[model samples]
Target: MSREESAAQARLREAAAARIRAARPELADAYDLASAEGLLAVRARIAEDTAAPEHLAAVVIGRFDLASWARATCEFALGLDPEQAAAWRRSFTRTVFLAGNPDNLRERFSFAHFADDGSAAWTDPGPAADSAGLRRLLKLFDGPRPLPVRADTVVEIPPRAGRRPDRPPVHRELHIAASGCRVSDALVHLNHLLAEAVLDGLIRPGDTLTIRHAPRLTGLTDRFAALRVDTDPTLPGRLRAAAGLTEEALLVPHHRP
Candidate 1:
């Protein structure tokens, strides 16, 4: 790439980052939009995949909408193609995971896995992960039959004095099956469901969440035999810590619903 072309691409990336920051201010502290690494990583992927970085970048940035861009970027990063694993990892390093109330979370916060290499794996709220995430979940299974997994929690949404009247707390439950998946995967899946419930306004901070797995699953009872809110102050932290994290991973607080 020529010096002028490189500079132009950098300018476009800065503009794109600004656009994203404007749309989601809460991410200002979460991601370093000024960094050139993310743009380089993304551009590399585009170049490798299509060998037309400038054209693809123009098309994606020409008429950008936050939602569509987020969806496309995430889907591309999570593509099942084995050959793109390195590219996907690079893309993920620039992505942020958004979880909480879908309305606010999608429009606000960002999440990422802090890596030892100083890169973060980020994901934004896009398509529901139920389908694709579940497909990935299936890969973790080890046995023939699916093991039952359930997570329940109660949320107390305190009323605003003048805005609304006091209401009772509500209970929420999420159920899934793991066919001999590792205890860790099962816990991660439960955490995913819990995050979804939080997005749906069914779970909230300070709420106690309980995970129930089939007794037959070895080592599960030992790890999360009687997990509760008192034991784990932050439910989302579990998802952040479960996997895809390195020894140097730093835990950042997620938005509360």
Candidate 2:
């Protein structure tokens, strides 16, 4: 790119970064905002729409860039007391998982959660075979009233046998304990985990992912909802098929200063 073109790109990135910082002040120190290439990629993703900075920040956070997420979380935590840091971490983690691409989520399932009223306003997916399975899995949390309790979901991805013989399997767990949270939120969190696992190259074709969700309730038996998903090679292909992109495209090579 020419100097003038580069300068203009830099200016655009700076404006976007400033807007993001203004909206999400806690993410002001996020390394992604400081990255020229990262900002360029974010810009390219939303090139068609004149989205607000809050929406832009949501895109960045929902990108599931592990390195950037970890760095921002650590840096922000360093400035807070232990208790506050822990609380912030929980909130940040939930935001990262819940802020995923809504289009992708809608393609698979129909879901909605109203935070103000803690009321469920969602319909199950169509009567397809896969949708039937999903409906059955979600039945564990079915109740007349919203449960005011916490639920922990554990996702276990076994390491690819031949590719990474020495690398260990990835095991991740997340908790949905916030006030006014609902089962739909947990489903979104799970969907983000599956997408992130594929993007991170932690999950491979033919691998079976074991997922379990245990709700904490008093005076109730500790019953956990368990399910396994067998991933095919086309799973990754389907995810990347969006926007006619074969793989994640970057405007430029990303590197930290």
Put down candidate 2 lDDT per residue, 106-157, tens digits, no spaces. Answer: 4565443211122122221112332343344333332223423423322223
TM-score of each prediction: 0.23, 0.25
What is candidate 1's CA lDDT for residue 208? Answer: 28
For model 2, the superposed segments whose C-alpha errors exceed 4 Å read: 1-166, 202-257
Error of 2 at 234 (Å): 40
Model 1 backbone overlap count: 7
| Candidate 1: residue 56 lDDT (0-100) | 8
Task: Give the whole-model CA lDDT for all candidates, comma-separated.
Answer: 0.30, 0.31
Estimate candidate 1's RMSD in Å. Answer: 22.8
State which candidate has the highest lDDT: 2
Each model's backbone clash number: 7, 0
Which lDDT tens digits does candidate 1 get at residues 178-202? 3344443443344333332333233
